[model samples]
Target: MATSAVPSDNLPTYKLVVVGDGGVGKSALTIQFFQKIFVPDYDPTIEDSYLKHTEIDGQWAILDVLDTAGQEEFSAMREQYMRTGDGFLIVFSVTDKASFEHVDRFHQLILRVKDRG
Candidate 1:
C-alpha cells in the first residue's frame, strides 16, 4: 500500500478572526492572504470564512480564517465569533484616523469576549 505525503486526518486547525472598522481593509487582507489577489472594492462583510491546508513549522495544519464585519450594526455577532477564535488580526487603515483609533476598542472587546484580560 502507498502512503500519502500529507495525512488527511489529525491535522490541527487554527481559527483566526479578523476585525476592524468598516472600510479598514479587513476583507481585502483576508482575501489577499487566501486568494492571492487584491480586492479594491469596499463591499461590507457580515462574515466570511476561508479554509486552507498547509505546512506550519514542519507540521501539517489547517487555517480557518474568519473575516468579520467592521460595522457597528454587526457588533453583537463579534463576541460569538471571538469566543471560538484561537488568534486574531486587528486591521486598520492608516489613512483613516478613526479606524486606526478604534483598534483599541476592538482589542478590548476581544479581550473581554475571550476573558483574556
Candidate 2:
C-alpha cells in the first residue's frame, strides 16, 4: 500500500464571511458550523474568526470563516472585512422579517465592496 502526501503549505484557503442584520443568527450559525453547538442566547458580535482544515470536493483546503457583527455601529468595519472575503454566507433569521428583507442590502454591500457588480 502506498500513501500520497499533500503539501500543507500549498493548500488553498477559502475565506467565507457571514453577514446579516443584528440578532439574525449569524453568530449562532457560524458557531454551530465551527464548534458543533447550538447557542440559544443572542450575543452581539463585533467580529469573530474561525479556521479549520477540511476536505472540499475530495481535496484538502483551509476554511477561514469570519463571523461579523450585524449592528449598525459595526457597519463601518464591514467593508474592511468584505474586501478580504473570497465568498460570503448571507444569514438571516426566518422569524425576523426585517432580517430577511435586509438580505438584499447585505448582498449589495458585499457586491459593492467586492466590486462584483
Candidate 3:
C-alpha cells in the first residue's frame, strides 16, 4: 500500500489577513479557503470572522480575520488592524486597475506599521 503524506502537528500558526476593495471578493476567498464552501455570487458579508484551528504545514492557526469596510469611512480602523497583522493578502480586481494601484499604498502602510510594532 502507498503511504499517506500527512504532516505532523508541529507547524506554527500564521495569520493571513485579506485587505482590498468591496467587490473584489475578499470575503469569498476567505470563505472558500476557510469554510471549504463556495458560492457563485457571494456578497461581502463578513465584518469579521474567526477561523479557529486552521492547519498549515502541520501547524495550527487561530486566525482572527478582520474584514474592514471597503468604504472610505473605515480608513482609520482599517489602518489600525493593517498595522497589527502578521501578514496580508492584498487583492485587487483584474478589471479594475485603480484598485491595483492602491494595494501598494496599503502594502507600504502594513510594512511601516509592522516595522514600528
Model 2 CA lDDT for position 23: 94
lDDT of 1 at 32: 94
Encode model 2's per-residue lDDT on 1-117: one tens digit a residue: 343555588899999999999999989998899889999998899999999887877787899999999999999999999999999999988899999999999888888988952
Candidate 2: where are CA atoms >4 Å away? 1-7
- How would you order the candidates by lDDT, starting with the best? 1, 2, 3
Q: Which candidate leads in TM-score?
A: 1
TM-score attained by model 2: 0.90
Residue 52 of model 2: what lDDT?
88
lDDT tens per residue, model 3, 1-117: 443454456545455667887677777777777688986694654367555565454445455666555656666777677666777889888888888888988788788878887
Q: Which clashing pairs does model 1 show?
A: none
- Candidate 1 runs further than 4 Å off: 1-4
| lDDT against true structure, model 3 | 0.69
- Whole-model alpha-carbon lDDT for candidate 1: 0.91
Task: Write down the TM-score for model 1.
Answer: 0.91
